[model samples]
Target: MTTATPHLLPGTEIAIESLPKVSLHDHLDGGLRPQTIIELADAIGLELPATDAAALGAWFAEKSDSGSLVEYLKTFDVTTAVMQTREGLERVAREFVLDLAADGVVWGEIRWAPEQHLTRGLSLDETVEAVQAGLDAGVEEARGAGHRIRVGQLVSAMRHADRGREIAELALRHRDRGVVGFDIAGAEAGFPAGRMRDAFDLLAASFFPATVHAGEADGLESIRGALLDGRALRLGHGVRLLEDITLTEEGGSTIATLGPVAEWVKDRQIALETSPSSNLQTGAIAAWGDAMVDHPLDLFYQLGFRVTVNTDNRLMSATTLSRELALVAEAFAYDLDDLLALQLNAAQAAFLPVEDREALMDTLIDGFEGAL
Candidate 1:
């Protein structure tokens, strides 16, 4: 089910979509298919801005490109509206995985805030169960279709909500079932990771891992809070971490100096889950410039930081993981080796046992070698 028009690596016939991929920062609510949204909305007696699938899809892409996170987030209202019921959630989750499989995502961590879907009498645990059920079905469907794919849930809590502790507990309850990790996502400006100290304390004490949404809508302090307070092993949309590095031109060569925060992230190999198209859309990389080439991800990669490419919201950005990689490859002049390196970075940073990670690396290496 790959796209008819392949997203190829620049100057090569290899379709990027055929490459094995690991997606670290995809949102569940943000990746629904347009026709699915329309059908789900119709079932719930919900009115949409557009009844046509293509038109509705265009609306989301248009609204998301507003270059303001808050404004961009407003599009979620339509998507989330149709996802309140168990049937809606299950269908959306199933389709999400199938889509990922078609795009060559071998492993993906799908994240969403349970609290947002509680308005229709579904408890947090119930919602998690529903999504897991759908994910399990999706995995089976993919396997039956001759695709090698796996997915895990990363339960997230909305930062604007005061239910951090509650959401953390919910995630822990289902840790053995399907949930792999926890996250705090929403507006990252006023709601620093420190606001959820008690929740992080609980997770830290229990040896649970978390990735905080930082260095995107906010700046260095937000990233500092994510690392120091949230105990984040990964920084979600951490594009702005580049601000900590001072760049200089010397003797016709560029030299970069890492500030304390940058040093800690780089030294510790904290994975930066960067989304190139979404970063430009949400203005996450505005300080650098307004194009894909201006994204700090290439700089981070060149600087030896654990840089991983992701499609933050495929529907919103009108992109796929393959398209994101192709865009980065085109912008940064990356070849197959560079693309493999980024996927290896993602596999290494995955929330899996060390043995599993090593196996994943081997899978990636085999896939790349076979492609060559």
Candidate 2:
């Protein structure tokens, strides 16, 4: 589903692909190459709906754009079906990093649930190891190819499952290896982050950071649970947080009033991992409007919220980080400086140490300056 050429800034000669970027909310299972899926499915004797790579890619994009998160998520069953083995996990992870590097991401955090891959007799720890191995190989390969990329894992627990603490421990166990943070993903409407209080409590005690999938399929209360109960450092697809913001016209100026929840998130500088195409496809921003111009990301950015652009599912959305940025730029009329600000926001919000984040910021500044 990727385009044949790099996406350039709307009225400029700059290719967005040339700027350094940081990706904080990409999904590993949601970014596999179509050809890789076909080969992996073939290895497992799994019959695919479409044998051709391009057709399979289109199929994922078609199914994912159903405007229902649940329906959109059903496409993962096919992607994950092929990701049930060690080789499958490694190859997908490696290619995921390579794709990110190709899209100009210098640092990326890939999130995936290990519990979903145990159907092939692999333990949760083994799954983490396999993915990390692939990520390392991808990083090495990218460096060899002169891309110089780095990646970490954000091991997730399925919200519908009862393995919150188990997955939390798994992430903690591999913290020094490659696991950088923790998350809980799945159906977000009924499954609040509070249900995994014990898991969040454990991570809190250990001082490990978390990014919860709230404000996407759910509303204000879910974001509340993510912060108060889950102690999330960032909100995954917090597009719906705009619900708590009230706008009114006063003397020819639009004034925005922030609710307590919105105030806290804004005051604390909690990053909103906003994915435009995926958000539109999942109806995460339906309350605002269905069009890319209607996304709250620009509003959040203008209001001084820590907003960062992302490609939540590259394969599902048939997009890359550069494409997401280019789309947002076209919709919002953002210039090179605005794009750099967004990248700096993401670099700051990344699950990395202060020195590392500073180094990444420097790299971004240098790269953007070079482009100018």
Candidate 3:
């Protein structure tokens, strides 16, 4: 599905892949190369649903489209199975960055749960070090190949697991190394961020940033817990926050009434990391309809929300950051300026220093100007 090549601006010569971009919600385990997974699983003697790389990739795509978040998560068993060792973690992280670089991502944050990588006796600290080493090497490799990409890790704790505070501490310990932020993911419907109150409290006291996985599998209440309890600066697939918005037409002018939660999110410009294909695959946008055009992303953009495109799981969604932007551009008839504004929105919302974000924005401007 990532074969969605660089799409032009409808009637223009600008190739979207040639522009600078930012990825804020990519997953480490979920972005593995099929061949990499095949080899890794082979070495570990783990039984795969498909022996061949192509079939394995297809299996992931099919399983993820099962339309239940719980079923969608089962595919991770294959990915995380191959990711239990330091070598697996490092190699996957390395290739993850290279793939993003190829897709024109100048800045990215890769989120993963460290607790899931300890089956091979690697400690939390060791797991982070391994991934960081690979990310650092990937950056150098990309730069050597004439691509400049910078990345940071978003350490996530599984919400249903009891290790939230532990993972938060692990993230804090690696902040100076390569960690950028903390997040909680997994089974969002029954497991809210409030379940991790101690973790959020600890992260809050340290003034660390978090982006909660909310509104994808749940509704406004989960989003509320994300902001009030998790203190999230961003929302991971917060597409369902639209449920809090009521829309109508008066005299041919659209009027949107926002619930208190939606009001705060829109008014504060909290970024929504909307992954198009992933949202559709996991049935997150079932209320709106089951197509990219039906996605609330365009509506959110029109209503002034800081909606940023993402590939939540590149392998599962079979997408790249470029492909996601291209899909949305087609769905909404977006122009080059609209795409540039989306990238700028992401740059501003990145978990970077103001000066660094400004530099990224400048780079985007220069590349976009060249395209124009």
Candidate 4:
């Protein structure tokens, strides 16, 4: 069923919710609907902060607004708890896809750590299978509802956990079945991508792609490890990549100098999965400034960096891809062309084959052209 979506853009009749968008860094565990969470939790005798859906949603929003990444992550405990069962996982995943479809996400890569779903005697493989089943159903459901949407799973290994290699293997095992790529998520400060070197080595050997959570809770050294060790083709919440860009104002114009790291990321055109609301909530953009306009996405885009907007955690940030796009457009004063460029950047960086990605690009081009 298509959920009703309010137009995020106010004055323009162009509905941002109907625009073609690709989400590269959405989290499976972080995108559950509040009412679904209530039902799922009730099924397992789990205690929730609030029994009512609205209050529960408010709790998540409030908890996530703490401006500390560590503090913000505590809300996941409740979400992950309910997802321990097959039913819980499937329902959440199904609703997740429906919500994305309603918000006009044409392509999305949903990431989650399968290891966390093992508390109910489910093996890692079982967890992946459960989620894949849900994703399959969701895709069909969305299609049946006359919404053309596609979602891929990015199986993530929790960096704070020691199951990186195992999760990578699990992802490879299901590559043909819905799983699209691999990632290492969770806390990023202490656990750099190098800490999962064995996992990265195997993923590298298997010719699999990865997108590491770097430059969010940490800095340049962490991003360096993601590229050099984790072999990441994309940076999750890489909002901190701005640390490498030095901007100096001379007279009335601004002069920007790219540091070695920024230059490399720019030259390689590696996609930065930037989440505006999430970044601000977690203080990821503090150094740049304390506003959404402080985000470097516009700067990155204008400078020719492959930048893609994302909702790192929809539930945590309480955001949809459309809302994120609207906020970015408002912050940067972007027009429709800028939006098309962002979608094209994401389509190009997708883990699919070159032909498939080009096809996605064509779809976006046609869709955006039609919108005009």
- For all the candidates, what are their Cα RMSDs to the real structure? 0.9, 0.8, 1.2, 1.3
lDDT of 3 by residue, 1-372 (tens): 235457566777777778888999999989999999999999999988898888988889888997788899989998999998989998999999898888889999999999999999999999999999999989999999999799999999999999999999999999999999999999999899989999999999998999999999999999999999999899999999999999999999999999999999999999999999999998999998998999999999999999999999999977788888888988999988899889998998999999999999999999999986
Query: How good is model 3 by TM-score?
Result: 0.98
User: Candidate 3: minimum summed lDDT over ten consecutive residues — where?
Assistant: 1-10
For model 1, how does the per-residue alpha-carbon lDDT over 67-112 read when each residue is reduced to its tens digit? 8999988999988988898998898899999999999999999999
| Superior by TM-score: candidate 1 or candidate 4 | 1
Candidate 1 lDDT score relative to the true structure: 0.93
Candidate 4 Cα deviation (angstroms), residue 237: 1.1
- Each prediction's total of clashing residue pairs, residues at least 3 apart in sequence or on different chains, is 0, 0, 0, 0
lDDT at 233, model 1: 100
Which digits, one per residue and each the tens of the lDDT, describe model 4 over residues 1-372?
Answer: 223666555447788887878889899888988888888888889999999987998899999998788998899999999999888888888888988888888888989999899889988888888888888899999899988899899999999888889899999999998899999988899998888899999999999999999999899999999999988899997878888889999999898999998999999999999999999999988888879898888899999999999988888887888888889989888888888999999999999999989989999999888886
lDDT of each: 0.93, 0.94, 0.92, 0.89
Candidate 2 to native Cα RMSD, angstroms: 0.8
Question: Model 1 misses residue 42 by how many Å?
Answer: 0.4
* Candidate 2: stretches off by over 4 Å: none
lDDT of 2 by residue, 1-372 (tens): 346698999999999998999999999989999999999999989999899999999999999998899999999999999999999999999888888888888999999999999899999899999999999999999899999798999999999998999999999999999999999999999999989999999999999999999999999999999999999999999989998999999999999999999999899999999999999999998887999999999999999999999999999999999999999999999999999999999999999999999999999999999998
